[model samples]
Target: MAVSTLMFAICTAIYIAIVLFLGYMGFKRTKGTEDYMLAGRKVHPALIALSYGATFISTSAIIGFGGVAANLGMGIIWLVGLNIFFGIFIAFIIYGKKTRQIGQKLKAVTFPDLMGKIYNSAFMQYACGLIIVVGMPLYTSAVMIGGARFIETTFSMDYNLALLIFAAITAIYVIFGGLLAVIYTDSFQAIIMLLGMSILLIFTYVSLGGVTNAHEALSNMASLVPASLASTGMTGWTTMPSMFSPIWLTLVTTIILGVGIGVLAQPQLIVRFMTAKDDKALNRAVPIGGFFILMLPGVAYTIGALTNVYFYEKMGKLAVAAAGGNTDSVIPLYINMSMPDWFVVLFMLTLLAAAMSTLSALFHSMGTAAVNDIWGRWRNKKPSLAETKAFVLIMIIVSVLLAYIMPGSIIARATAMFMGLCAAAFLPAFTHAIFSKKPSTRAAASSLVVGAVAWFLWTAFVHIKESEPLGISMLLFGQNAILPMPWQVVDPLVIALPLSIITLAAVWMVERVTTTKEEDAAEKAI
Candidate 1:
């Protein structure tokens, strides 16, 4: 190996050694399923905050959505605001305390477990678990792609090898040490991410001669937008697309709104609340989480937009054009070409940290969901730690296969797709479970079915981006989509989430009326 490659390898080895040491510490502390799944429910506020933030902002946020910003321009900034406000403020203050209290009260160890206990029905657990097992791999795959892309860029390694290695390394701790290991390592990764992102923003601004100059340079290139994008409604890097245009709807409904509101129902994110020791910990986490959120996505999006300016000035090409048409490559390409060698190594570690932190949490959640809700329910027993480990290994392989099969330039879209489905399927039922005095199982069930089905139907038929590739609509309807313009561009979450909410409300009201009448009529001599 070259001297530089050898030095970089040494640094990475040291970092991984530290992470493994922390994982071992977690292993030593873990005494039972509770400790493995919920970190013994005594995590410090800072650890909780960092773990949550790190898990929330993965490689998908940095490399994937950052690349989206490069393609779609600064308009992607809306997502950062929603991430902080809805994902942090509303989530911690409104949902965290309730989830922590109720989870403790009912001895719920997983998200599905909490739902099942809330409704006094094992079916709730089974349904939620099935969703996680089936749907989470798409997201997990996308995150792996983000990490592998950077590793491929950094080490000049084969994409397939990078993906397998990334998957295997991230799986080790999650398989053996479970959630506690995930939490400690994720917290450490979070600090790395903060430093990396902070330096990235600084370097980007300095390269472009400070913030104002960068924004102006990007703004001045409005007329340079590609014909395809401009015709679709994109105005420029610094401005929103034309209202109700195809690009505008896609940006507003699909990218921005999809992920913005979708964060509420994410299984991995919600489980963080269950690990909190008390309401005070949750409260203390808010500002810390908010700051972390502001720094990561905020910097990613800002730097992404500015990369266009850098490319235009340096090579007389747009960011996407400079990257040869693949948006996913834009951020990675820019980093390699623009940053110093030492910074490249540092940022490579950041991407690794981002990917591993999120992947560890995802593997832990999926494994526990499989054990506590699906397989364990089938076996009619509390699953052994060995069983959870086995399932974690299985899930890692599944996600790795998915990452291999998924097409290029897919990271952002897949992330949105997963988040949107979660919003449509889980948001209504999850909200009802934690807040309602008596959450209606029938209502929650109906909502889950309708929401998931609606979203799938829309994606497979009406949403052009997905439907065109899936070819389901073509086979059934003789066209890529069953609809024209606007509707084709509208995100499924926009339509399905409302339907889910309405289904739950309607069912709950009907149940309330019938139950009241039945009570008045007496027990019918049973």
Candidate 2:
């Protein structure tokens, strides 16, 4: 125990030193709001790539979802494919350049600013900001829980204490240095994660014989799949489930489609586009971002599946205690028990780096959204620099409190909720703004109201198992009961996104026809 504690302390000191150094650099560079919020809008391509990758792949991916992959088998690999194709390829290549062009055109600093300027509506800006402020805490809490859970498992520390300590440290750096510090630290953290996961993957494979033997072992344990899952058309990890069953629906719709499509609409990520030097910078950064995003999650999830083999061989049962008798503990337990002490120390640092990188980005985004989007508008004049700093501090405090109070199993659920909300509320308006010449204000407003209400209702009442209707989803159909068919099981995004697009188009058509008739009457009268 003394050795383990000493190892952790050394690793922590090294990690904190690096973070503080980056924060100092950011502080030296920060001269104004623009510098603090958007890294002076001159972030290098490589750092942007690293920042994007690090933010996208958090402890939620490594520890939380890694556990999910371990329990669920190789089926979770679909998530990695989605991350590359949608999160990186489409996001960076297609959306990234276009978004940068538009954001620069409008001088938009925050995601809410982009929406407000594109729609020419302060209401939309406030609405988007409110959604972020309310919804982001859920995600923040989940990440905190993930890091805390890992620490608690490995070091036998109090979960609450772990959560508080992690949140406090992250909040301090982010509140002080903002986006530049976050990006600099994220680049460094991304390196640690890549190296750590790669080493773990190699070690786990070698320790449990070889790749071929690991596959054979996993194949032999096909019977271990839950009978209920099998009945729902989920075969073992070796094969895909049926096309549209619950397991397939959950995997494809919620995990894959939800997160994949949702990446385009992620505010923290979208803001990265604005930080790039130019279109050339964005273009150059795409491949680097894609590589890091693909490799880290790819290795982590692959190792997750292989943990079953490790458990069976070591414990004679396909279970690890850290996971609370669940499969999610498979990765953490494997690292703690299977790897050498030095590697365990390395893995802990990797996890800490992952958690802090993500938290810093998240807090910075939230603070900017609150200060630049919501509070700044209410001020008759621009706020003083001190006021902006105060707002950042307030946001950090709120986020830290939320993290401390969050439940343990909220990671996946919170992720889905935020992604789903972004897809429903922002996707249609954003698409129309970029593609259409004369997207009507009425259309934009109608889309926001309809999409936000529909998504809230569906998720809160109809779709979720026991949520109260009026709580959020009550606006849809004015009922507190669940909907039937795909709505019952499908993610709310599937319904709300299409509904928003259709509503926007319908409103535009009506407005166009009305204007045409009015113009014809004026010609006749003249």
Candidate 3:
């Protein structure tokens, strides 16, 4: 069932050519710093919606999370609902419109710039930017690993070579054309992804003899559930895992809520709102964004779960077993074994699109943080497009190097860990900034510090999934995690995000009370 590598290479070349052409168009349109950094705040509504959707649904979401769906069952569909609800509807209607208006009024160019300007504090800008510069690479490197690993395996190329090629191609556009180029190429890539996933869904359901039969067949395979998974509460491919079981906690908290709620504060995603011209654009984009988000992960997760029936029928083995128990390999293995030769090429393009779209946005966000927020704010200077581009190249190199250092398992945790961190560090303060008329700088600072610190401490000392590998807890306390059973299994986001919000609310109230008392004393003296 292997397809022609030469054919894949040719199709990939054409895809890359179109992407580069779009990037070139973006560069042509980019005539000022605003154009380069914020797409001139005049991007088309459809383009904004498509680019935002593309940036959110990366290769990790499609392949890694899809593989998760294959192994963990259709229960992961909960995340799809949250994605549309929070990632699109709420993000655009509640956050995106506000962000657009405020960002335009303040002339904010990046997420950190928005924060710094809103607070009127240079320290706020630097700290936000610093967090992005330091933590974004963990997510960025995970993305690089996903895309490059696919290229290496699919075309039989060297991993290092694949990594370099992916990095260089994405960097060239982002560094030269900036956010304008990133969005332009993103819209183009989004189309490819939509087409590719649409085809994947049709092919999967049709090949399984139809939707009803596929579900029935999969449900029948409940008895085929591996003993290992059953012990952890897996019921079947179609049902949710046992409530409060280890699997349930991991699925619901770590996978579902960690990413679902975490999407609100993603620096790269928030930056897309700043690219909008007005509330009208954001309002118009809601349904478009919602539909785009639905098609991408919705199709991936559904097709991923149904892949079990296909494998069971063809190989008499389940999806995970068919791929030799490596969940990461499940989707690719299914495609190679079951899909048509032409579709293989298209799917490969789909993955590349997912990777490039997200990567370009990450590069832009990181670079802007470095040049515009951190360095420029510190020096009290306005950064030029050239300087930001240089920093973009630097961040790209940093992320590529980190990809070599980090393990492939980061893919599974990429969305959860990175988004969790962003939510913990920025979400509360970001919410306050946009919604509160008289936001407290002290409260914002304290929340950022507390949230980030709490998230890291929990990851390093309490979350067994992360702590066990980190070995920090074992090194310090002779244990993998400081807690036992359910506590160890619970995700950091669940612990840290609430703590972050509490810290913000507590401090803001304290400051408000203090100021009110001071004003009363002054009035008595007068």
Between the candidate structures 1 and 2, which one is better when assessed by TM-score?
1
TM-scores, one per candidate: 0.98, 0.93, 0.98
On residues 1-526, what C-alpha lDDT tens digit does candidate 1 reach at each position? 1127876898799889999999988888888888889989999999999999999999999988898899888899999999999999999999889999999999999999999999998888999999999999999999999989887876789999999888888888888887899999999999999999999999999999998898998999999988999999999989999999999999899989999999999999898999988999999999999999999999999998889999988899999889888888888889888988888888988999999999999988888898889999889899888888898888888889989899888999999998999999999999999999999999999999999999999999999989999999999879999989889999999999999999999999999999998987786645
Question: What's every prediction's RMSD, in angstroms?
Answer: 1.6, 2.7, 1.2
The C-alpha lDDT values of all candidates are 0.92, 0.79, 0.89
Which candidate gets the maximum lDDT versus the true structure?
1
Winner on lDDT between 1 and 3 is: 1
lDDT of 1: 0.92
Q: What value does the lDDT take at residue 184 in candidate 3?
A: 91
Instruction: Give every collision pair in model 1.
Output: none
Which should have the higher TM-score, number 2 or number 3? 3
What digit string (tens of lDDT, one per residue) describes model 3 on residues 1-526?
Answer: 6678799878888888998998998899989777888998888999999999999999878888888999999999999999999999999999999998999999999999999999998878998999999999888877777777666656677988877988999998998898999999999999999999999998988988898988899888899989998998889989999999888999999989988999999999999998887889989999988999899999989988998998988899889889877676778888888889899889889988999999999999999899999888878888887888889999999999988877654676866899999999999999999999999999998999999999999999999989999999999999999999888888999999999999999999999999999999999999
Backbone clashes counted, model 2:
3
Model 3: per-residue Cα lDDT at residue 52? 96
Q: Cα lDDT of model 2 overall? A: 0.79
